[model samples]
Target: FVNRNAFGHFGLSQDDFERGMNGFDMIAPEDRPRAIENSIRVMRGEKLGLNEYLALKRDGSTFPVIMHSTAKYLDGKPVGIRGIVIDITETKKLEAQLRQAHKMEAVGTLAGGIAHDFNNLLQAVQGYAELLLLKGREGDVGYRELQEISRAAKRGGELTRQLLMFSRKMESTLQPVDLNRVVEELRMLLERTIPKMIEIELRLTGNLHAVSADISQIEQVLMNLAVNARDAMPDGGKLTIETRNAIADEEVRRSQPELTPGNYVALAVADTGQGMDKTTLEHVFDPFFTTKEVGKGTGLGLAMVYGIVKNHRGYITCVSKPGEGTRFEIYLPAIAGTQATPPVDARETELRGGSETVLLVDDDDSVRALGAELLQMFGYSVISANDGESALQVYGETRGGIDLVILDLIMPGIGGTQCLERLLEMDPRVRVVVASGYSIGGQIERVAEIGARAFIHKPYDVDEMLMTVRGVLDQE
Candidate 1:
C-alpha cells in the first residue's frame, strides 16, 4: 500500500486500495462478477492468469478491458497482487463495424433484384405517357383523361427513384431532422384524407428525439403507412398514430443490428381492422404480398416502407393476428436537431407565356402541339421544331430573339442531352427549360447547372405552364 497522496492520484482512498476494492467498483455491472471470480481464482493459485472484462467509469458507463494479474509473494506466502489492465473499447468498436458492413452487403444483394424490375415498369410508364398525351386533342375531355394518366406515370417514376435510393444506388443529402414537426405539419392533409366513418387520433409526445433522416423520405414512409392503414379498414375503423422516445438496449440489439444502444424515435401507425394470421404476417413486408384482391392493391406499400426504413439505417416491426388488428412500428436513430425548412412554393411548374418568339423542340408531335397550345393560350408567341436539328435551324434563323427554349430530353436520334449542347452553342444567352419524363436521369433537377433557368416535367396544367413561363421570363 502507498500513502494517501498516491491513492489520491488514482481517485481512490488508501483504505479502498488496501482492501482490494479500488478496481472492484470500477468493473461494469454485467462483467463485475466474472472479473471478481477470476481474481479469486488467481489468488488461490489456479493456473489461469488473464481475463477479459468491462470496466465502468464514475458516470456508470462501461468499456471493455483485458485485466492481467500475477500473485506476489514474500517468504513463499502470497502478500499482494500486481495487475495490468489494458483498454479494449476500440477493439469492440472495430468488431461492430465489421458486422454492420456484412449486414449492408446482404441487403444490397436483395435490393438489386427489386430495382431491376422497377426500372422496366418506369420505362413503360414514361413511354405510355408520351403516347397518351400525343393522342389527345387540346381542351377535349379525352385530353384531360390523358393528363391524369401522365400525372400517375410521373408518380410511378418517382417510386422507382425511391427504390434506387433504398438500394443505395442513388444519392441523398444526409442531415439532422426533427420528426415531430413533420407529422404536425401533415396533420391537416391527413385529416382531410381519411373517410368520415374512420376515426383518427394522434398521440405526439414532447421532449421527443430527433433523427438524421431525409425529410422527404420520412414523409413518404408516413404517407405510405397511412395509405396502407386506410386500405386495411375499408369498412371503417380507428387509425392511431404515435411518436415517442425510445432506447435500443441490449435486448433490442440482438434482433436489429442496424440499431445502436442509444436514443431513438418510434413512429407507429396502427389500424383496427381484419388482421392477418401468422402465415400472412410472415410475408407482409414482401413486395406484392397484399391480401387485397384484384386491382385494389399493388402490394408494394409495405415493401416501399421497408425499403425506405432500411435505407435510413433503421428497422421496422409488424404485429398482427387473425380477426384482430395490425400495428407497424419504425425506429429511426435520434440525433438532436431541428427540421429543415421547406422551399418556397411555386405558383406554376411548366413553361407557358412569352410574347418573344420561342424555340420548342420535341421528337413527338403530340407533346409539341399541346405544349405550343398551352403557351399560346397564355398569350406567348410559339415557334416549334420537331427535332434537335430543326430547333437549331429555327433558332439560327431567328437571330436569338427567342424569349425561351423548351427542349424534350428523349428523342429518336440526337438525344435531349446532346441537343441541349447544340442549342447552347447556337445561342449562349438562350433561356432554356429542360422537360423530361424522369427517363433522362435528373434532366429536370439539373436544369440550372446546364445554363438553363429551370426544368419542367411534361403533362403540364395550363396554370402551372403559365406560372413557370412567367417566373423564367421575370428572371430574364
Candidate 2:
C-alpha cells in the first residue's frame, strides 16, 4: 500500500506517478469505465474485493490483471483506497495454449480416422486400376479411361497422405538434411509459382549444421510457409527465408516448453505483409483455421507444418503484430558429425520381373488376392495367407522355397510386428517387405529394426510391386 512499485511494474515512471497517474489511468481504455465503477463501490465501503481488468502499461502494452481494492478510513472518515494488482499475462497465455492444443488434438483424431479408412478404399481402387491397365492395349479407349481412373486414385492417395500428415499419423524417414539446399530448390520453384507482386528473398546461411529430418516433409514445411507468406502480402511484400545455427540451453528450453537443451538448426520465414494480431496468431496452426476467403485456402498448410515439425522432434514459434508483419521460426535438432544426405530423385526405376517365390500375408482378402495376382503376373510364384497365424504356418511349410514375404502391417491375429518377429526367429535370413494401408509414424522403423528388407505402402501397381520385389531380392 505504501510502495509505488506497483505502477512502476506496469512500466510507469516516477515522473508519471508525480503527474497524477491514478488507478483509472492504469486501466485499459475499453475497461476503464468498469474499473471506475468497481473502484467507486470499494470507496463507498461496499467491500469490492477482486476484479479482473485489462491493465494498460506506460509502454502501451495491455495485460490481464487481478485488482483487489478496499477503502482505507481514518476514524470514520474515508481517506483513500488501498489496492493490489497481480499480472495474469502468463496465466492467460497458458489457458489459451491449452485450449488450442485440445482443439487441435480433437481435430487430428477425427482426421486420422477418416484418412485411415479412405486410404484402404483408395488402395483397392488403385490396385484394380493398375491390373486393368496391364491387360488393356495402349491407345485403346478403355486403356485411356483406366489411366484417368488410376491418376485420380493417385491424387486421392496423395490427399489422404496429406491428411495423415496433418493428423500426425503419416510415417516419415528422418535423415540428415541440408536446409540450405532445400531452400535453394524451393526458391526456383517459388519463382515460377508465386505472384509477381511478391518478391522471394533467400538469405540462406552457408555451412549450417545438418538437422535430422524428413527431406520431403521439410520441403513441404518451407513451401507451405512461403505460400502463407505470399498470401499475407496481398498488394506487395518481401518474403525472406533465413537459416542459422542455434543452441537452446536451460533458459531457452524453459521459454519454449516444446524444446530441449540441444544444438538446433534455425529456419525462419519473415514477411513484410498484412501481419496478424494476437488473436489471429494463436490459432494459426489449428487445423482448418485460416483467414483467406473461400476457395483461396484449405487451412491445412500451417497445420501440416506443425505436425511435421513436431514429428521431427522440433519446435516452431510464430511472432506477429498488426501492421508489423509476421515471422515463423522453426528449430530442428542438429547432429554433430554427419554430412547432409542428398535427397533421392523420385524418377521411376525400371520395372523388371523376377523368377522368385514370395509369401503374401494380409487380413484383407481383396488385398491378399490382388498382391498374389500381381506377383504372379510379375513372373514370380506367390503363397497367400489370410492372417498372421496362417502366415506363420504357411511360411513354416514353404520356408525352403519362399524367397521374400510381403507382410501386411495390420492383421486379425498376431499383428505385423509380432508375425515379423516370429518369422525372423524361424528364419534369420528371411527377406520380408512390410506393407500397409495405414501406418503410424514409426511403423516402418519398427519393421526395419526387426530385419525387414523393405516396405511398400498399400495400393501399389504391378510395376511398383515388381520393382520393389526385385530390389529387395537383389540385395546381398
Candidate 3:
C-alpha cells in the first residue's frame, strides 16, 4: 500500500497504484538490478544504511534519490520491504556548480602567469624590429622582413591581451554605455563579415537604461558571440541581437542565485542554427574547448566572453538544444541618471622625440636593452638599471640630472610600487612613468594614486612609449 506522499513522489495517482504498480517499477532500468540487490540485503537484516540511485517518474524523466529501507516481517519471516525516498536533484546541481567554480579559478591563475611572461618576450622582439625598421628605407633589404616580424609580434600581443582579459588580469576603463548604440554601430560591420546568406536583425528596446562597462570589452563580447552564431548556422539562418532593461527581483534571484536584486541592461544574441547538446553546453565556456575544426577556431572566444562578463560584475546564461538554436543573454548592472559616453579616438598623432635625460628600469635583460636603445635612438639621454634597487641608486646619484624615470612595475627585487614610493620619498618633485606588461587595472590605479606621472603598457609600441616619456617630462 503506497502512501499518498509516495504516490506524489512517483508522479502517480492512487488509482494507478491500486492497479498493482510497485516501487520497484519506479527504479530506472539501468539501476533496477542494484535496487533489487539492495532491497534483498535489507530484507535479510543486513543494515546497508541509505542507498542512492536514479528514480524514474511517470513522465519518463529521472532524478537522483537516496533510499533508506528496513525489512518488514510477519511472525519472524520477512514479508516485505519498507523505505523512504529523498530527492537530491538540487544537491547534485550545487555540487556541479562548486566544481566548475574551482576549475575556473585554477585555470585563471595559470593563464595570467603565462600572459605576463609571454608579453615580456614579445616586447623585446617587437621593440627591436621597430627600431630596425626605422634605420632603413621602405623597400630596403630586410625592411619587409622586419615589418613582418613587427606585425607578427603585434598579433602575438593581441592574443596575450585576450588571455589577460580572460584571466581577469587586464584593466578595463568603465564608463556609462548604451547597449543599443553599440549594437547599432556594429550592425554594418557584422553584415560585412558574416556570410551573406544569414539574415541579421536587431530588436533593441527604446529608452534602454545605461550600464557602466568598458566599451571596448563590451564590443569584444558582442563580436565574439556574433562570430559564434555565424559559425553555428552554416546553412544560413536568422541572427538576432536584442537589448532591453530588466529588474532582477525576488523571483529572478530565485532562479539565478548569482544575481543580486538590482536593475540591469539585458543584451542577448540568438541564432537559429544547429545548437549544442547538454554535454557540449556544460563545457562551452571552458578555455580551449571547441566544437569547430582545429584550424577554424581557437576556442578562446567564448572563454574570453565569459571572463569579460564576470569582470564587469555581470551574469551570462546560455540556452540551447540540439537542432533548436542557441541564445546567449548577458545582464549588466544599470547606471541610473547617467548618459552613455561616446568612445574616444585613441590614435597617436606623431612620434615625439625628447632631449631630456631618462632613467630606465626593468629586470628582463632583453627588455632593458631594447628600452634603453629605443630611448637613446629617439634623442633621449638614457641611464639603465636591471632592477628597482639599481634604479633608486642611479636616481639618487643623478637626481639633479634625470628629467624622467621609466620604471617597470614587476621585477625580482623592490618592485615598481615600492620603488615609486621610495623615489617619491627621496624627492617629491621627481617625475616617474610606470610601465608593465600587464594591462591597466587596479595596480595601475594604485600607482597613479601613489604619484606615477603616466603609464605605458608593454610589448610597447615605439610611438606610445616615446609619447608617454615626452609628455611626462613636459608636464609641469
Candidate 4:
C-alpha cells in the first residue's frame, strides 16, 4: 500500500504528513524498550506476547496501553502485528485482597479448634469442683475450705470460657438481641462489679437498634471493659457507658477493611482514669501482652474482645492519651425491625424429675458419675455409659425404655451424636438431650433447626440441668 523506501506510514488518519511527528517519535522514553521488544517479536512472525507500556497521547500526556497482537505474514514475510487488549489493574487488586482474607480464615479455624479442646478440659475442672462444694454440708469446717477451692476453679473456667468465646468455639445462639433491654438488665450487675470509689454513668443517645450477636459475649465485652476501667482508676474516677447510632463513611471504611459503610448501633465505654500512650495502645489487642503486673492480668481480655467484635462483623476503635483517658467504641450492624421476643417463662425453669429412666453417655468417668448422681437426686433412674456403643447397648438392654439420653458430643468411638443417630434408628420415638463442653459441628445451628429436646452446656448447675431436662420432657 506504500512505497518500499518510505520511512513510515499510517494505517488510518494520515493527517501527520505535513504537521509531522511520527508515531514512534511520540512514544514514551520509558516504554520504548517494551515497544521495540514487541516489534522484534512480531517481526519474527510470532505473537507479540503480553506486555504493558505507556503510550504518549497527542496532548503530551501518557496513558497505560496493553497492546496484544501476533505477526501478520504477507506471503511468508512478516508485515505487522494485531490483537485486542484491555486494562486489568483493578482486577489484580481484588485478587490480592481475596487471598489475604482466605489466609486469615485458615488461621481462625485452627485457633477455633485449639480453643474448643481447652474449654472442654476447663468444663470438667469447674463442673466437678461445683459438685464437690454442693456435696459439702453445714457444720463441716472443711466446707468453707472446699467452697474457696470451687470458687477458684470457677474463675479459671470463666477465663477459659472467655477465650473460647473469643475464638468462636463456644455454643452461641444469636437471636434478635435487644440493646436497650440488655443494658438495662446488666446495669445492676455492672454497678456491683465495679469498685465503690469509681462513679459509673450510662448515656443512651439516638434510638437503640437491635443487632444480631451472641448475647453473653456482648455482656462479656461490657464486663471486661468495666473491669479494665476499674483497674485503670487506681485513684478512682468516672466510667461512662454510652450507646447510639453510627454511619461509616468511605474514609473510615477504607481504614478498616473488614468494616463497610452501613447502619450500626454503637456502644462505647469511656473512663476518666489514667490513659494509655501510643505504644501501649498499639499492642492493646495483642494476646498475652500487658503492662499490668504479673499477678494482676491475663492479657487475653482485650484480645478476646477484639476477636468477638470481628466475629460479629462489627467495628471497634480506641482513643487514648497518657494521663487523660481511654475510650472504646464498638459499632455493630443494626438488625431489622423491633420484634418483641417472648419473655422466658418461670414454669420452664421449674425443676422436675421423678421415676423417668435416662441413659447418660460421656467418656469422662467423673462427669458421667456426677451427671447420674445429679439426675438420681431428682428421682430419675440414670443408666451411665462411657461411650456411644455402650450407650446403645445399655439402651437396648432396657428394651427401648429410655425416656431420655444425656449424650456428650465428644467421645472416643461412637460418640454422643453418632450414638444418638444409631439409637434413633433402633427406636425413632426415643427422646434425647444433647450436651457438649466445646461447640461442635454446627451444634447450636443444629439445635435451632432440628427441634432438639434440650441442650445443657458443661459447668452447668444442678437446677439448670434439671430445669432443661424437665422442660424438654414436659413438651412431650
By the TM-score metric, which is better: model 3 or model 4?
Answer: 3
Q: Where does candidate 3 have its weakest 10-residue lDDT segment?
A: 436-445
Arrange candidates, best lDDT first: 3, 2, 4, 1
294: Cα error in model 2, Å:
4.9
Q: Ranking by TM-score, best first? A: 3, 2, 4, 1
lDDT (CA) per prediction: 0.70, 0.85, 0.89, 0.72
lDDT of 2 by residue, 283-347 (tens): 89987788999978777888889888878888889999998899999999999788999988888
- Candidate 1 lDDT over residue span 1-476, tens digit each: 44454344335575665667666776778887887787777778875756888777655566787778877879997766667777777677657556645664566556654654554455455545545565567896677777777678677666556555445444334567667788887777777888878898889988887787777778878888887777778899998889999889977776555688888899999999788898888667665578888888766667667767876778788898766888999998787666544533545355445576666787766667767765665567899998887887788888757888888766767876777777788777778887653332334435456786766644443454567667877884
Residue-pair clashes per candidate: 0, 0, 1, 0
Which runs in model 2 stand beyond 4 Å of their true positions? 11-53, 56-61, 67-83, 195-197, 250-255, 276-280, 290-297, 321-324, 344-348
- Top candidate on TM-score is 3
Instruction: In candidate 3, list every pair of residues with a backbone clash.
Output: 171-440
C-alpha RMSD by candidate, in order = 11.1, 3.7, 2.3, 9.6
State the TM-score for model 4.
0.69
Question: For residues 1-476, could you state the per-residue lDDT of candidate 3 as single tens digits?
Answer: 77788778778987876888788888899999999999998888999998999999999999999989999999999999988889988778767877986887688778878999999899989999999998888989999999999999998898888888888888777899998998999899999989999999999999999999999899999999999999999999999999999999987876566788999999999999999999999998888899999788877899899889988988888999999999999999999889999878887667788789988988888998999899889898998999999999999998789989999998888899999999999999999999886743578879989999998988899988988888888788
Task: Give residue 444's error in model 2 in angstroms.
Answer: 1.7
* lDDT for position 408 in model 1: 75
lDDT of candidate model 2 versus the reference? 0.85
Count clashing pairs, candidate 1. Answer: 0
TM-score for every candidate vs. truth?
0.54, 0.85, 0.93, 0.69
